[model samples]
Target: MFGRFAQFETREEYLEFLNAGVEFVGARDGEPIGRYNVAPGTRVLLLNQRDDKLHLDPVHWGYQPAWAKESGRPPLINARVETAATGRMFKPLWNTGRALVMADGWYEWKKSPDDAKIKQPYFIYHESKEPIFFAAISRFHPDALDAQEDDGFVIVTAASDKGLVDIHDRRPLVMTREASLEWLSPETTPERAEELAHDCAIPADEFAFHPIGKAVGNIHNNGESIIKRIYNPLV
Candidate 1:
């Protein structure tokens, strides 16, 4: 459900990969953007549209608008792609808040057969280890440059089919670079954006998933070692 992800590229590399002429606000150039464990309630680098221009900003990872505050529901790190545009909490951002999450890969937990309490962790990435852009929707501040910690966003997720479902029932809606650019473009209509969510997502076979150590389950654990492929299963 996009609860955890990693981005090991530098700020320059991420921008260059997108190459969309995006303006950076909160982030500085040449900054080391490597993050092995990105959890909820923290700032995440996002490419979003504002003022008729593409921008890169650090927006909070949880999605909880002002209207939903009284409901006492916890902030959501994910929004189902099929319903996010029509969902009560996300409808407001559907038309204008489409965005892209810059992540190298994401993690999912598998319930072990040996024990109910133990959940095995898996790392999912492109087979070739290329960068991925996860589709998202955000409730960003009106001021693009001066984004607040409360201006939050949620990754759009779709139901998994075939083998990937073994890891998790859902996976983030990842798009190709061109489709991702279109997803964030102001010219693209909401109907087309929804279509892209379903039609343009990269297939499960394009990715590979392997079991990893359980240290990633803890938010404090960070480093290349945490993502090392362990031949053995913890469960």
Candidate 2:
């Protein structure tokens, strides 16, 4: 359910991960932390494929269709994998568009019945410490945007795997670094893209999750503590 995530602060840090080929998006300097509000308009880096080159773009955090007068939608942060192929909002882009939303880790909330205000935060990431590549589909709104504006993108998601099911029912579709390059390859055909999206999954054995402090709820709070393990992981 990638509701909130940590992101790189500078273009240098962002490109370093790119040069190293880390492909997930929405990374932060901190971990195991909480943010109160991480609404749209937040500036985040996006790695998009264009003319065979990986273009690093910083776009607003939410997906906004210029035509829509009101953005009543919940954060346009994730596109359900099951419906991405045929849904009007995601189909056109997935048919010919794709990208790698890079991230070191992501956050999800655990529902609590006793206290509605008490939501637990967990940081999910690879056991090996590699950046996660969130399989994404993006289309340029060349005709949809006003003049002088550039392109934007959205991330694709699916039901959570075994490792994350306990924390949330859904998770961002993730790809390994090797698969990320292929997904971002301009030469990849539409058929190839569909196969990649359909077949891709990060095994439960490869990832680790841990509960963290509730400080992460504040979008303004950014630091290394967010990723710190609040309780020793059972794994």
Candidate 3:
């Protein structure tokens, strides 16, 4: 499951590809700056469809369904694509609440083959170093007695492809601009939505990854330095 990612693009940079007006609503502490290490519940930019048009919006990263809150269950940060459409927690948004979680890259920890307890961190990003979009789903939460709170979204994941299986068992469901638009369109049928979801898994070869320092393990360590590559002889 994906639990950390990086989004270094400025608001203007995201607007270049989004090509839509943005409404900043859920950014933490009202800070709209780019983040180098994003975890669950972190505020991130999301592209959502509304009234036949796409809009850039800020939303919480973790999906906290009302039932989970009532049951005291943990929020979900990643939902498997294979079960997202049928899973009880995710099915509601399968066809109508699709979204795009924008990020430049993501982080995954690889266990050392030689030692079960040893793990190394790697930063994965597009070969071209451009921003990548992860397929996502969003749901609204209630603030009071039937009053609505802001929407929260969860990134979708798929079985790891050839190049990534060695690093982890799952990878984020990535999409191209065309696939993103198709997935986010409310006009898309359930069958077509499933097809689009399967088609958007980014090829592992399209990503470049390298070992990074363990500083990233701490959520408090946030900055460009957190993603800098570091030599790992074991890797």
Candidate 4:
């Protein structure tokens, strides 16, 4: 359900937030800021097992198994939870490639009869002011694509929780510090995966949502105001 996100403005800002030590319940590696608009080709942070360590790397947002590129299907943005375990697009990784995607907040649109031509943007995140670590799942790139050009990733989405249901039909599988650590472990088993998926919802009282200006629709619009709370009746 997330289309737009807020990325850290500076590397230092990112380091500070990450160093706050709230997200390590899963993996320990840190990541840089990300693109405002996360699309298929966008590079995103991924946590994977490597030599007994959880390594975080930037990966392409689109997913294409090494042997399935010619399947004639466009890349998918979100992987459905109901079928991720058995779907042709997500099963391979479902067995053992879960990951974490770091984000400050995500954008959602609201449609109204009064403004058919525009959709209001809402920024959603933790009410605690902590950065959000969206739960993710990844697979090894079958091809040896350039590190900067060909890494791949996909976010897992679940049925909306009570507070978020009105905003979107599906919401990302947001990880808790504990669940992230469990999902990132190379030793994580299928049974463990099911447990993690079942517990991904954040309580309604733990989150905050606010309408922001239309400038956020433009990928070029990057500022704290994008997530600043605004009350506009038109929204």
Candidate 5:
């Protein structure tokens, strides 16, 4: 499962990745951001497409449709790729509501071998130090904010394998710029989106994870130091 992550890059730096092709909402210096510890149920940047133009919108980060609320289901922060395209909870978004969740990295907890009850935290980030674009699906509508409690989204997740399996059995489906652009493009078909989720996920070797202090377990604690390596990863 994926919950906590970081995105401390400047708006212009990130906008450089998407380039001049996209429009920015609240483009006035892009205030109120630079979050190093992003948790669920908070506002975050989402890159989505509408009206043949790309948009970078700050949106709520959880999804709970009216029917879900009436049914007493909690808001969803992550949606599984195994069933997202066909699942009832996400079918509405899989084809038309695809989006990109920008981040520097994410955190995961591993069970301590010495104690099953204890878990150690690790931060996973791209080896290149570039921004990560997590594939996502959303219920966001620029003109329909009232359609749900608030316009929110869910990151698409896939089963983890290779080295990352030791840290967590699942992870967010982080994608490359090319793959991310395709996912957000209106020209992509539902089948292609699903295929992209399965075929374009970044390899575990492309990411580097290292142990970090448990202070990150608390959402209230945040900063660049929060992601500092507790011990040298290479050692």
Candidate 6:
């Protein structure tokens, strides 16, 4: 599961990367962003499609459906792609609420076979050094008092590819621009959406990973240093 990630680009860089005339909402000037850790519940940059157009907006990372609040269940941060299309919590949003969670890289912890207590962290990024767009779904809580803050999203995860299976059992559903557009397309049907979710897994060879300091395990630690590579024999 991808619970933490980094997006270390300026607003101009993001615009160039998206290559679309998009609007940015909820961004604060001089705020230390891009080079920090992003966690669940944190407001994050999201690329959503509406009426065949992509719009950039800030949304909460955790997903909370209207029924979940009444059920008193915690927010869902990750949805398994294997069952998302048929799952009770995710099925409703699978087709209509798709989005792209923008990120530079994501963190995964590798458990030590010799020592269960030792869990080493690693930062995984695209080999091309381009941004990774995680396939996700967004929903607006019906009972929300504030629309902006209440809109939430959850990353979709698929079985890890060969290279990353040792580090984790699952990885976020990373997508290319074409795959993302198909995913977020309003014209896409539920069957096609599910098919895309199951088939659009990024190849493991396209990614590179390196061990990082344990500082990333703590939510209090937030900075570029958190993702700094460190030598680890266990890795």
Cα error, candidate 2, residue 115 (Å): 5.4
Query: How much lDDT does each candidate structure score?
Result: 0.84, 0.65, 0.79, 0.66, 0.84, 0.78
Candidate order by TM-score, highest to lowest? 1, 5, 6, 3, 4, 2
TM-score of each: 0.91, 0.77, 0.86, 0.80, 0.91, 0.87
Model 4 lDDT-worst window of ten: 20-29
Model 6 over residues 1-235: C-alpha lDDT tens digits?
6798887766555545666443444343443355557888777877777774566667888977667788898888999988998888888778678888778899898888888777888999999888778998887643356764337889999888788887898899986666776887788898998878777767888999899888888887887898788875364
Worst 10 residues of 5 by lDDT: 24-33
Better of 4 and 6 by TM-score: 6
Candidate 6 has its poorest 10 consecutive residues by lDDT at 23-32
Q: What does the lDDT read for residue 97 in candidate 4?
A: 73
Clashes of 5: 0
Clashes of 1: 0
Ranking 4 against 5 by lDDT, winner: 5
Question: Candidate 5's residue-wise lDDT over 22-129, tens digit each?
Answer: 565546355435788899988888878885776777788899888898999999999999999998889988978999887899999898777777888899998888
Report the C-alpha lDDT of model 3 over 24-71, residue by residue, as the tens digit.
333223334568888887777777777665566667888777778889
Instruction: Report how far residue 92 has shifted in candidate 5, in Å.
Output: 0.5
Clashes of each: 0, 28, 0, 4, 0, 0
Tens-place lDDT per residue, model 1, 137-166, is: 987776557866458999999999878998
Q: What's the TM for model 5?
A: 0.91
Worst 10 residues of 1 by lDDT: 20-29
lDDT of 4 at 2: 56
Root-mean-square deviation per candidate:
2.2, 5.6, 3.8, 4.2, 2.6, 3.1
Q: Against the correct fold, how does model 6 do in TM-score?
A: 0.87
Give the Å shift of residue 196 in candidate 3. 0.6
Clashes of 6: 0
Residue 83 displacement (Å), model 5: 0.4
